[model samples]
Structure formats: C-alpha cells, structure tokens
Target: MKPSLQLKLSQHLTLTPQLQQSIRLLQLSTLELNQEIERFLLENPMLERDEPDGGEYASGPTPAAGSAQDGVNGSEQPSEQDNRDAAHEEQQGIDWSDTGSAPGASSTRDRDNDEEVDFQEFQPAETSLREHLDQQIALSQMCDRDRALARLVVEALDDDGYLHQTLEELLALVPAEHGVELEELEIALRQVQSLEPAGIAARSPQECLGLQLRAMPEDPVRKLALTIVEGHLELLAERNFARIKRLTGCDDDALRAAHALICSLDPHPGARHGSDDTRYVLPDVVVRKTRGRWTVGLNAEAMPRLRINQLYASILQQHRGQGGELPAQLQEARWLIKNVQQRFDTILRVAQAIVDQQRQFFDHGAVAMRPLTLREIADQLELHESTVSRVTTQKYMATPRGVFEFKYFFGSHVATDTGGAASSTAIRALIRQLVEAEDGKKPLSDAKIADLLGQQGIVVARRTIAKYRETMSIPPVSQRKTI
Candidate 1:
C-alpha cells in the first residue's frame, strides 16, 4: 500500500477557558458553587469584596437578554425601603435590584458606611449520631477487636440505621487493622444491636423489627409480634390480619395486642439524624403562592454577593495610568475575574430556564406535575442535554409545594386513556395516594385500580399497574385480599 498524506481544513468547536468555567459552574449544585466560590476567594488575591469607589450610579452592558426585568444591576444602594422593595420584587418574580452594589453590600455607600453585616448562624448540635454511637461503644464491655468490627458495622449502616450492605461487603470495606472475618463482623453487629436502640445495626426492616421484638422481656405478645415480623411481614403489609391471626394461632384479643406491639417499632430507626448530611439544599429558585396565583423567582438570598473587586480594579486603573507595560500577571487576573462573572451568568440563565420549565410543579404540586426531560429543556435553552442534566441533578427549588430537587420535574411519559400522556411520576403518586387511602380490610387490587384509573382516563394495563404497585412495595392482589 502506498502511503499518502493529505491536508484538509475544518472547523470544530473548542471550549474557551471562560466557557468551560461557565459550564462547570452551571453543573455544580448551589452548595458546591458556594464551596467553589470560597475556594476561589482563598486562592485569588485579586478577587475580593470592597467598598464602592463612590456612591455613583454606573451603567454597563445589561444581563443577557433574559425574561427577567432589565434594569436591575449588582450595585443598588441598600436601605430599609430597598430591602422591602427587593423582597416584594423577589416575591413578584421581578429581576433583582441590580444597581452597582459592592459584592457584600447592596451599594457602595452601605459598604463604606456599615462595619457589620448579618451572617447566617451555624448552630451546632450537642452530639452527632456517630458520636452518640461511639459513646455507647466506649461504655460497653466489648474487646478492642470487637469494638473495631462493631464500629465498621455501625458505620456501614445507612441513615435509616439499616445495614443495607452485606456482612461480607462490610468485611471487605473494613481496614486490615481490624483483621476481622465476615462471621466476626456479624457477631460484632449483633453486639452493636445490644446498644440503647435495640435494632440499630440490623440488615433489613424485618430484621430490625425482629431484633427489637427479641429484646423485649418475654411478653407473650412480643413473641407473637416477632413471629409476625420474621415470617408474616408480607401478610401484615397487606393487612391480612386474619391470616396472621390464624398462622400465629392467636385469638382476636391476642392478635390485637400483638398488632399493637408491631406498630410501636420504628420502621426507620436512624431517620432522625437527617438524610442529606453530605450535601445541603440551597434552593436556587423560590416559588410562592399569592392569592391563589403562583409566583416564582430566583432565590437572591442563596446567591453570594458578587462584584468586581474595587481595590483590584483601582490598582489596574492606576497601573493603566503609569502606561509603561501591561503585566502578563494582570492579564491572567482579568481572565479569572471574567471567568467567575461568566460562571454566575450561566448559573442565573440555567436557573431561569428551570423555573420556566417547572412552573406548573410550583403551582399544583406533584399531582399536577407536567412531563419534562433534559433534552426538552436543553432544546429550549439551546444547550446540551448533558448540561441540563448536570444542572438539575443536585439542585433544588423552594416551591409552593416545599423544596424539591430540580430533577424531580423530569419524568417519563405514560399514555393515558384519553389519548393524551401523563408523567409516570404522576401515576406513581396517584397509586401511592390510592394505596394510602385503601381500606385495610379490603385492599384494592392492582387490576381493580388499573380499571378505576382507566375509567378516570389513565390507561394503565393490569400488569403495568402491578409493576408500579410493587415498585411502591404494595403486594399482589392475593396478598392484599382480606380473609
């Protein structure tokens, strides 16, 4: 084969540094963006908050042609009236009052005049969950290896205090400093269960309930409750009181007592500690209900005060006057500031896009949730689907329905009997509501519910209805049917 070389000219898109920073900031959750800002402040000497040079109103290129009101700038003067009006504007979904304010202060005068700015207080709790468990372990009589293994097991437990991971998996995760086998890990787990919360380290809901029942001081009803949890949880979940009564060979009074005992056990023992310890929700948007109408706004409170560093800008201005040479370092500093500003701009744009798409969710809650997808959002905003996905993933909005993940608005479409479509999420929500309100003595069958939904214009097949029902942990028709 003859070797040939050819040259052709073609254009391809390349991400500029500023564009890349914008994309990166757009993808970060609000908490993550705050952290990124903090890290940038620590590393960049040129970027900072400062008193405005003068109490003068200045004009620049306006915010990107957005739907928000056009006149607001970053440097508005702060006053009681300004605060009240700003709050009112925010509630009305108007753009923030964006006169040239110093990064931390609403205006230059406020920055120059005020010495103290009110900061959000971080109130620390008395004792953390891990600390509470450690204290219990310390007061116990377990040996060092046992304590070590128990610590691994306890740590392996999820926020609900259920050991979702297997003993083998936990054994693998534990360091060799513990030098424990799976059997030893299991044994240590059992000992951890002996702590104050009787079922803290159990592997499943049934197991947790069983452990709690076993720890009771030999009440006859406790044994019956343990029997139900250990072997008849499916029956109990379906509210099959008759089958449970028959199988346990308990009379009505005894079964009632046992059922009462079963009800007392915690389904989620560790839920009290809070679920998202790793990430906090700083809602990027807020939706309010005003006189039966829904109003939405970008949460200005959650946004950090950002402005061009006046001190650095002044220094750059002075250096410009010297007129000898523009330093390479100064150019780099300018690039950084531009990138940060672009980042915030992108975030604001993306936030607006999300609010626009999910406005219905804000108005009517989950039941009225409309179908949305990343591709749809991306197409609307002229951005990539991946960019939309990343923006929505960990982000949250404080809506009239309360705070929800931004991604919650997106759901798969399911065909309805009316030839229209509904979000699968909405159907699931409907099924949950139906199941919650079902009569325990005669629980609704999936097939019956499917028929009922069809009558209401949602055309779900019996099997499809069953699948969604089971996904929600609701059992089969046979399991749900009463005696």
Candidate 2:
C-alpha cells in the first residue's frame, strides 16, 4: 500500500476567496453587510467611501424616518421625512440600503448652495427604573433612617417592580451593624408601595393589583375587585366567571364590572419607568404597488456606496506589480465592490420571487397567503435551495402591511379537500380571525378552531392549531373567555 504510486484523476468543488466573500455578503443582514464593508475600507487602502451624488444615487441631507408609502410611486422625489431618515442613517454610520437611491433619499446638493451648516442636537437622557425610584425617594418627606431603609427595599425590587426577595432574604442582605429589623423593612416597603405608580413595590402581582384597588375610592366594584385580586386572582386569570360567582356570590353584571376594574390595574408598574430602547428594522428591499402591480426595490441606505481610491489606483497603474500588496489589495477591493453589487442583485431577485409567490399575502393579508417553499423559489430562479435559504435568512422586505423578515413568507402547508394547499401562516391568520370574532361568553377552543378550518377545506389537527396558537402568544379558550 505504501509503495503504490499510481495517479488517479479527480475533480472536486473549490471556493475561491472572491466566491467566499460573495456567499458571505449574500447571507449577511443589511447591518452586518455594512459592518463588513467598513472593515474592508479600513483594511484595504485602495477601498474608499463613494460620496453619493445627484444623477447617480442621491443621498438626501435629511435624517428622519419615513412610512412604507414614502417612495412607492414612480417618482424618485423623496418627501421631507424620507430625506431626514436617509441623512440620519448615514450619520449613524450604518449603511442601511443597497438600492442606488436610499429609501428616503432626496437630492444631494442644495439649490441655493448657501453656506448653511447643520447642527447636532442633544437628546435628553433616559432615566432607568432605579434612577426614577431614587429621585422619588429623594423628594419624599421621610426621615433619613426611613429613606435609607426604603432605598434598600427599592434596590431589592426587580425591573418589573416586584420584590422577589422575601423579608428574611432582604434582611440578610442588610448588614448586622445597620440594626435593620423585619418590621422596619416592612414599613419601608409600604412607603415605597405608596409612591407614585399605584402598583409599585409589591411582592406579587396579586399584591400589586390589590394595592391599586385599595387606593381607589370605596365603591362596591372596588371592594369586589380588591377581594378578587387578593383571593381569586387565579380564577380571574382563568376567566372562570362561573366559579368566581360560585365562590363570591356575585351576579354577572357586578362581576363583569369588578373584572373590568381589575383589568384597569397595571401588573408591572416599574415597567413604565424601565428603559425603552426601540430597535428600528432597515428593510433590504421596498415592496410597493405601481400601476396595479407589485414591485421590489433595493434600499439605498442599506447599500454602502464603495469605490476604489483614485489616488492609489493611479499610483498602482503607474507602478504595476511594484507595490507588492497594493496590486492584490486593488484586485480584492474590485472583487468586493462587484460582490456587493451582486449580493444586492441576488437579494432583489430572491425577494421579488418571494413577493411574486406571496402576492396573495400582499393583496389580502396573511389569511390569503398560499403555500410557498424554498425549493419552489430556487427552481424558479435556477438557484440551489441553500442559496435561497441564505438569501432569505436575515433579509427583510418593507411591504405596505409592515416590515417582515424574508423567512416570514415561507412556512409549512396544510392540505385542502380540493387538493390545494394553504400556508401555515394563512392557517394561523385564520385561527386568529376565528378567535377574535368569537363570542366572549364562549371562546373557541383548539378543537373547535380545527373543525372550523376543516369546514374551510384546510385540514389542521387540534394539536397543530393549539401549537400555532401558542406560537402566536394567543391564550387558551379557558383564559380567553369573558363574562
């Protein structure tokens, strides 16, 4: 075996660096792709940012967000909001578009060419839950000892304003030298609970609602609400009005009123004071109707305008093969530029294909969505299923309905009696419709929902319906029922 020296011809697939970059760029989300471009710009001296210009891709100076219908029409003219969003995205150092023009792009130059300059305005700081509570405690008319004890209690409370630690546990956190007692801590807890946001500083949700109920005026509904919150909260959550009546001896009208009152209380008071960081999604393509037909356009903001450095290019051209790595860098930069363009081109093609298949979804919402598969799209586009999968992974489409990931358009199918198939998305949408339109006194169960779908020629099992419902965060019939 060791002496064998016979040569055999073989062929295997190989991935070039350029091909690898193209594949990677295709799979990355718009944000990730932009980040990769920035890295390349830093690493490759030949690569540079291409300043957006009119007659090409017009980068508007405004930096404000726009609605789905911002640039839908045949007009390239951007609204004021669109211009602002485009400019803001550029300033944020995030390339959000791949289209030649940004989503909210406007003209690059000013008509007057006035020497007007832009100013950066400072946004006020957002206070955290602890900071908010501390401010309130500071302003309160409490003794230093009480204030310190209350501050300790506030520290023990979680972001949801619930005190998860028991009095003993909290007491242990206190130093033995502080001389803090259980009663003192209880008094401090009451002080914090009595602060603004009625349900704050409660040990449990029941106590939170009960505190709010206790603060309300002494009406029969308030009393009943408090009683229910403190004792029959589980029954109330289950929506078992019958059992509630059996236990509390209340009539339908009274229980309904009390239930309404209970619903008004906030379960998480501290959540209002919690830091709210809204993450805005930048769609890779914009879907809109033009002349009664749906069309997909790449987002220009998501596109990082890249170009080779002319100075370096000229020098390299004059001294070919002399700069050693410079020649390779230039070639690599060109590959990246071509690859980026190809990446977006591939993305646009896949997204358009998806829109074509899910046209019913765009026209009549999710309920009208038909069955779709990566195989169907791949076959139509003459691409591998894995390529289609990569294209749709982190890519997003901006439809008039809302911003949705490319993956949302793909789902399992349920067989129909007429030999047709319905998308799982559509089935879930149907379930939601059925549940929403159900009578409050008797909500639809999974079995009933399944039967309802069966009548519609869509064969979905009760368990499957339940699973879809759970995924949608919809409650069971027992929890959905009302008086």
Candidate 3:
C-alpha cells in the first residue's frame, strides 16, 4: 500500500471552544455551576460579577463595544489616564485617610462586622468516626501495648461499624517486635467495642445484635432475644415465627416483644458517629402560583450574577489590534457571559414546561403526577432529547409543596383499566398509602394491594407491588403483622 493525499468533501458537526463550554455549563448542578463561574472569574480578569443587589443580567441584545462610553454620565467623560488612575487606586488599598469621614459608612461597617462575628461563632467542625473512636480510646485506662492494638482494630472497622477482617488478619498487621498475639487482639477488640455505641466492633449482624442485647438488663424477653440472635438468626429474618418459637420455646407475646426489641437496636452503630458534613440543596428554579396560575422563575440566589467588566473591556477595545492575549481574553469573557445567560434561560424554559405538563402534581402532590418522558418535553420545546436530559440532570425546582429534581417528573407509564396510562410514581404513592393505612393485626399482602389497585382502575402486578414496597423500605406482611 502506498500513502496518498486525498480530500474528502463531507461536512461534520464540530464543537468549538465556546460550544464545549456551553455544554459543560448546562449539565452542571447549581453548586457545580457556581464553582465553574468562580474559576472563570479567576482565570479571566475581564469577567466580573455584577452587584448582588442588582437585578439579573439582561438577556436582550448585547451592547456593542463602542457603546461603553454610554456608561459615563457626566458631560466631560473621564479620559483613559483617569480610568487607569482609578483602576490603580482600586488595586491598592482604599485610602480611607483621604476620604475623611463619610456619612452612613461607619454604620455599614459596624453592621457587617457584627454579622461576620455571628457566622464565625455558629460554624460547625467536621469530625469523622476514627477521630471519635480515638478520642474515647485516649480516655480509656489501658496499657500502652493494648492501646496501640486497640487503635489498630478501630482503624480496621468500616464505616458501618462491622469488623470485616479476622483476628489473624489484624494480628498480621502489627509489628512482630511488639509481640502482638491473637489473644491480645481479641482483648483489644472487646475494649474498642465497649465504646458509647453499644455494637461498634461486632463482626456480623448476629453478633452486633448480641452485643446490644447483652448491654440490657437480664429479663425474660432480653434472654429470649439473646438466644434468637445467637442461633436462628436466618429464621428470624425470614419471619418464620413458628420455627423460632419451636427453637426458643417463646409464646406469641414474648416473641413479639423480643422481635420489637431486636428491631429497636441500631444495625450500624458507627454510622451515628460518622462524618458530620451537611450538604444544602439550592433549587435552580422557584415555582409559584399567581392569581390561580402556575408560574416558574429562576432562583436569584442560586443563579450566578455575572457581567463583563466594563472598565477592562472598554480599555481593551480602545487598544484593539495591538496583538497580544487581551483580544482572546475579552472574547472568552463575552462567551462566558453569554453562555451563563443561555444556561439559565434553558433551565427556566425547561422548568416552566415541566410545571405546565405536571400541573396536576403541583396541585395534588405525587399522586396526580402524570406519565411524562424526556422526548415529550424535548418535542414540545423544539430541543434535542440530549439537551433536555442535560437540563434536567441536576437542576431542581422549589414547588409549593417541596423541592424536587427535574427528572423526578419523568417516569414510565403503567396501563390502567380505564384505557389510560398512569405514572409509576403515582402507582408507588398509592402503594405507600395502602400500606400506611393497613390493619396491623392483619397487614395487607402484596396480592391484596395489587387487587386494591386494580379496583381503583390501575392494573399493577403483585410482584411490582412487592418491588415498590421494598424500594420504599416497607417490610413484608409477615414482618408488619402484630398480635
């Protein structure tokens, strides 16, 4: 084969730098988008945020570079040298000495200082599970070698408080010179398990339950619970009350008490003392009702208020064609401002369309949520399906009832007896209601729930009911029944 040069006359879609930035910004969540904006502000000096108190950036036509002169109001506009002098003053510290005493300025500073102090005092410190366990170990009265071994065991425990490694495995981790043995590790393990959380270092679910049961007073019920945890844990999980009774010789009332007590114990004790990081969700759009009409608007707090730095931009325009990186930076700044505006516009439009389609949901909650899909919204808004999916990925809307992700409104349809379709969300909500209002003495089974839904014009299967019930963390009828 010989190498030859050939020209193909075919056109293909290509993503420019600006287009790629727009796509990346569109898919980011509110928090991520704000971080991206901050990065752009740092990298590009020509881009700066508008005043927080000022309204959002105007989505109308972007003014020409020559129109920057309109920003100066006085008859004698400031010259280039005056602008440079002002920029220099801003770069340096503000000269409060030259400004003398200004009215209302001291009051503003006092108010800001007071707010800063309050925020600093209320801020929380993050602490992890290992740190908490180490603190408790420090206060314990243990010898040096035992304390070191206990620290090793504490480090081996996972986030769920379960010790996945065996005693031999942990012993191998210690240096031989320390003369650590399996028996010493076992003692250290018990010492670490004796922390505030009753079952912090158990090896299995049964052992975890046993540890908690042992912590309680020796009563008939507690003894029965301990026996059940020691042996017959599988039968207990299967809700095989008859078999458990045969093995433990407990009556219905005693078995019920033991089962309740077991359920009350924490399965993952270490989770209670885990990381204390809090994530706050900020809705991208705010939906409200006005004069009996539903309306959707952008959340000002969540949206990034960005604008082209008029001073820098005007200066660059005056010195145009003096080849350097200034022209590229200015162009990049314009692209960012336009892209941010476009990203929010797309979000607002998609949110409005969702609210319009799922108006019943806003009016009557999840039960009234109809069957919707990305294709339907895309077709209605004349956008690509991928674009719609990107818009709904992490965007959230604050409705009258509560906040919900944009994708929550889209679900598969379930055929109904009335020749119409019902949303899977609505079906799940109905199942939850049926289970909540069920009789404890005779809990409704999956088949009965399916039949009830069938009578209500929704045809769902028993297995589907079971799946949704499990998804909602509702137990089986056997587990839900009472004496």
Best by lDDT: 3
TM-score (C-alpha, index-matched) for candidate 1: 0.63
Candidate 3 deviant stretches above 4 angstroms: 1-10, 58-111, 118-124, 174-181, 218-220, 245-253
1-483 per-residue lDDT for model 3 (tens digits): 999999989989999999999999999998998888889899988777766654556433334554533343326768998799778767886776676633456888888878778675677765677888898899999988888988999899999889999999888887888787789899999998888688889999889989999988999999998998899888888778888988777899999999889989999988977775788889999999999989999988887767666667677778878737877887898888789889999999999999999999989988998999999999999999999999999899998889899999999999998899999999999988998999887899999999999999999999999998998899999988764
TM-score of 3: 0.83
Superposing all C-alpha atoms, what RMSD in Å does each candidate have to the true structure? 12.1, 11.1, 6.4
* List of clashing residue pairs for candidate 3: none
C-alpha lDDT score of every prediction, in listed order: 0.70, 0.85, 0.86
Ten contiguous residues minimizing lDDT sum, candidate 2: 58-67
**Clash counts for the predictions, in order:** 9, 17, 0
TM-score leader: 2
Candidate 2: Cα lDDT at 305: 75
User: Which lDDT tens digits does candidate 2 get at residues 1-483?
Assistant: 577678799999999999999999889988888889889988999887766652233222211223222222325767998789868887988764555554434345342333354332346678777788889999999999999989998898888999998888988988999898899988999999888778888988888999988888899999888889889999888777889999999999999999988888889988988878877789999999999889999988788877666667667778886988998998898898888888888999999999998888899999998888899999999999999999999889899999999999999888999999899999999999999999988889899999999999999999999999999999998888888
Ranking by lDDT: 3, 2, 1
- For candidate 2, the TM-score is 0.84
**Taking the tens digit of each residue's C-alpha lDDT, what string does model 1 give over 1-483?**
999999999999998876677677777777777788777667665444322442221222222322132222455558998798678766887544555543345666676545565443445655645667888998899888788877887787777788778877777776887566778976888888887677787778888898888888997888888888899999888777777877888987887788889889887767665544564567776766668655556666565544444445445566775633334434444555555455445555666666676666666666767677888878888978887777777777786567888677788888876678888778888888887788766778888788778887888888888888878797775665543
Please list the residue runs of candidate 1 whose C-alpha ends up more than 4 Å from where it truly belongs after superposition: 1-8, 50-195, 199-211, 214-220, 226-243, 266-278, 289-293, 320-360, 375-387, 470-483
lDDT of 3 at 275: 71
Better of 1 and 3 by TM-score: 3
